[model samples]
Target: MYDPKIFKTYDIRGIYPDQLDEDVAYKVGRAVVEFLKADTLILGRDMRLSGEKLSGALAQGIVDGGADVIDIGMVSTPLVYFAIADYGHEGGIMVSASHNPPKYNGFKICRERAIPISGETGLLEIKHLVEKGKFEKKPSGQLIRTDVLDDYVNKILSLIDKKRWKDAKRLKIVADFGNGMGAKTLSNIFNTLGVKMLAIYSEPDGSFPNHEPNPLKEENLKTLKKLVLKEKADFGVALDGDADRVGFVDEKGETVTGDIITALLSKEILKDNPGAKIIYDLRSSWATAEEIQKAGGIPIEYKVGHALIKEKMRKEGAVFAGELSMHFYFRDFYGVENSDLAILKIAELVLAEKKPLSELGRPIKRYFHAEEINFEIEDKEGKIKEIEEKYGALQNAKVSHLDGLKVEFSDWWFSLRASNTEPLLRLTLEAKTKELMEEKKKEMISLIQG
Candidate 1:
């Protein structure tokens, strides 16, 4: 049975065998080929236990739908995007439920040049096709087993010249791969550079025996933080299930939010591409824009979601973009999330400054953030309108409905958005002072909870 719930705003994800078995994968594959009208497509998967069988079924359907499949097996989601954009495949699919538990699995679809096919783009039609359970049969296509790992790694290394070393050896890092796809490229890059790194759970295991592959949760990063302090490493990084997202831990065991990374990278990226536009999600701290402006780069506040950010970057010709969820997009990588490249960029910044990661990130922490708060409300938009009717009337408030409701003042700001993937309302507030942030956050909560 095709569980319509699996078709999400971003991708198709659900519990394996139950909600998203081989049958669903097969049907989705057929729908993708039929919809894209593609002659050839690239395919890749993560280290999920169910990936092997599911990929086999998906390839069968793609072949049945008259599109040849270039199966780049057991690679990161970034690698799949690279194969599609850099190699010029018509479209592609990555079979991996990013950051989800072991029992869950899914697929991320993309078009030519790695453009994502979100619910707004074409996922809903694909869902309907799967539900209809019908496809016009054509000549069965061939499946070619290919490995693009070497090329992907070379692309990552090209950004950071290995010949120069360039003080890179002076930096030491503690990385937690969480037994996901990150271990593949990180291992190759560090080995080629001969950088000292304390790698934890580097092995590619579908079970994710060490911890859940989500770095956003503070608990998942506890071991990484501990190792960084114990090893006296300059910094630490944790890669999520598919290695497309990442989280950073500084030298002092402080968690560096994604926005702060954007601010830090702004300084480094702007040095080369002066006046380049950099996009950050609206949830980011004000210091993100401040740092970008200071570095002579244009800072653009955009709504969240990887697909939307990628499109916004392409349209604005942004050199870099970062989301609060730790997804970093780079123009060099065709405006897609590349956690490996993000890591290398951070390393380069630290090496160039000859300072600790904390020192490099300190200036970016200039404002007070209430952190993201989530409320489970049945009527999310109704509550948002209620809050808007109240705050929008303020004489000094500037309201924007870009991704959600954002009311801003000279001293404070807040963004309330309904999550695209889950049934929840997310609130992000910041202010010039910590006290002000707390006060505003509390006030916002009352409105949302009511």
Candidate 2:
């Protein structure tokens, strides 16, 4: 039996063999098939050493549950989503840890366009079934191997016009794959685009020799930044373990946050699709909304998380959506979130402007944003309640509880929310000036700690 503790707020993740094993994986597969009543399912796995074995066992379980399994071996998370929708399968699962350490592994599931399973959605039910060991066994169905990589690459390339890429002069770019699945798929796309690419750690090694695949961490991005400047490349791109999240570095060796990229892309999209609806997560910079409005697109802010963003996109009929954590979703792409597509879009926009990305970002409004701060506390709910009671009555400030306690003032706002994954409270603050942001952040921290 697996430890119940490993079933997380987002996906099922844990150390291999000890916390998660083939047995647990099979149980999860059985539960997923039963839960969705899936007659046919698409499955993909990352390059982790354990992935192949786990996927095989999971497929076995699915087949045993009388569900046919279509295995697309060794692919990224987004590619799995694509295979599911493109092939019109009933549901799909990607066996990947997604930016976690090499020792960790997990699954990302989807049914149609909806991420049907989350911590509160169907994960708990799956967990309960796994623990109870009451899975119903049935006759074996079928398993088939289908190589969809070429089709996936073709589909992604079709999203961008080839003439646009060919018209632009070839630009030198560096891509640090962090030894994840990105290395496996990026080559085909970049070669087709005719870009001069310098690939680093382009092998699929789950141990992540050069650095962890998480580009959000400055330490993880240090090498990519230095390399970009050293090679004088136009830009550098970084991807997470499953290649679902992307990070960028400009020619000047400066790391750009996902929010800035979102603004840049939203402006480009609005130029053609005027008044299109764009969605950004609440944690994004205030400039994101202002830029969307400036570009003549309606800006809609929603709670954090891919599932939340996708749902809001459907509800608002939003054409595009971006998250501060680097997950970008496109409605035209069957609403499947793809960081590779976002990176390519950014490249295309920069080429179209004939300007450096840094220069293009200057006219946009700038706001001082504090990195998300996490506070470890015994009572997360109590601390949030205290923060609400203290800040709820402040004059000239509006209080909201959409995702957490968000207090909005004329020039500044702060969001204090309990993290779903850990026993901690996360705080994000932004303002017109650095001084004001710091001042408010200090006050909010004091109140929250007390």
lDDT of 1 by residue, 181-229 (tens): 9988898888888778889999989898989999889999999999999
Q: Candidate 2: which stretches are off by over 4 Å?
A: none
lDDT of 2: 0.85
Over the stretch 59-112, how does candidate 2's per-residue lDDT look in tens digits?
998998899999999998888888888888888889999888888887887776
Which 10 consecutive positions of candidate 2 have the poorest summed lDDT? 161-170
| Global Cα lDDT for candidate 1 | 0.91
TM-score of each: 0.98, 0.96
Best by TM-score: 1
RMSD of candidate 2 to the true fold? 1.5
The TM-score of predicted model 1 comes to 0.98
